[model samples]
Target: MFITKSINTFGSYLMLMGKVFARPERMRSFFKQYTKEMSQLGVDSIGIVLLISFFIGAVICIQIKLNIQTPWMPRFVTGYTTREIMLLEFSSSIMCLILAGKVGSNIASELGTMRVTQQIDALEIMGVNSANFLILPKIAALVTMIPFLVTFSIAAGIIGAYATGWFANVINPEDLTYGLQYSFTEWFVWCGIIKSLFFAFIIASVSSFYGYTVEGGSIEVGKSSTNAVVHSSILILFSDLILTQLLTE
Candidate 1:
């Protein structure tokens, strides 16, 4: 019964997502909402993303320094390896997974509140296409902003590596710069961008799905929010694996 019910719910969620992409009744309304969501999801999130990414790069640099003691091995390789890690996954996949927790819950709770309060029903009664109005803007904003966030995270991580390695005497500036440029692959950068887009959709769609289907009041809203974060995180990791396979191999 549980599996059956889960499958049914998944089916319903897929249908709702399809409806979200339908033509908006008012492009102006959607555009306004899109800008608002972009600010909320991207600009507001910059500080936290940078802070975390910096720490990630710093730690990677230290780890590389501590592990390699051979004279034959160049110290600058740490910077290059750090760059590869950040570009390949740390900046994009990991950052989006974190945002899944932050942004996904926010989206779910907002929509769940509207659902329990009947705001969505009222919108339908007023002939407003609620899904297109409320959800499409969010998805659109995320699709655009997340790639930018991924870029920010990459820069932040690189900056972090440079700062920590230079100040701590762990690696010289020239070596770090050389390492950063070592075998840099454009394919890795493209893979990160693709992962960011896929993760953005997963977060927005899953969050809104749980919220839009909520059946009760405040307690259910909270539950929906929690479920949104959990489901989105899981799906992001799963999709990351699939995307990495397809994009890389």
Candidate 2:
């Protein structure tokens, strides 16, 4: 019974998403919302993303260099590994995790507050499509911004890894460049970008669903916000696994 209900709920959610995409008014509202969310997700979050990406890049490079210190180890392995990881996983997956904490939480809180305050209800009463008006914008914004954010993350990761390699003398500047050039794969980068797009959709939809469904008072709103982040994060992880498997296969 529980499984059946869950399936039904998921089906309904998909239907709603379809409808959202079909509506012109919702599309317009989504564009407006997209602009606002793009600023928050891309521009405002840049500092944190850069900091985290840099540290992650440095740590991974250092660790790989230390572990594979054999004389037979290729000089370019460090740079190649770093680039591969950044292009394939770090840029998309790790950045999405950060976004879950930032954009996901914000979406949940905003929608939860509106739901608790009866603003959503008021909009419904006024004959507005609350779901289309509120949720579509968030989904649109995230889908638009995540790809760009992933690009930024990839660039930051590469720079960070390069700096660490230079400082540690693991690879000379020319070798580093060669490794990076040799490691470049358009397919890996494209895969990461696709993953980012899927992640954006999952985060926006899950968070908004929690917020839009909120009931009761302030306490319930808070609960919804927490639930939104928790569930969205879980879903993101699950989706990531599935996407990885599919893409790699």
Best model per lDDT: 1
Predicted candidate 2 versus true structure: per-residue lDDT over 14-44, tens digit per residue: 8767755657465566677678877866678
The TM-score measured for candidate 1 stands at: 0.96
Candidate lDDT values, in order: 0.89, 0.80
**Model 2 misplaced stretches (Cα beyond 4 Å):** 1-5, 15-19, 26-30, 168-171
Residues 188-225 of candidate 1 have per-residue lDDT tens digits of 99899998999999999999999888998999999999
Instruction: List ranges where model 1 is wrong by over 4 Å.
Output: none
Worst 10 residues of 1 by lDDT: 68-77
Pairs of colliding residues, candidate 2:
none
- Per model, how many backbone clashes are there? 0, 0
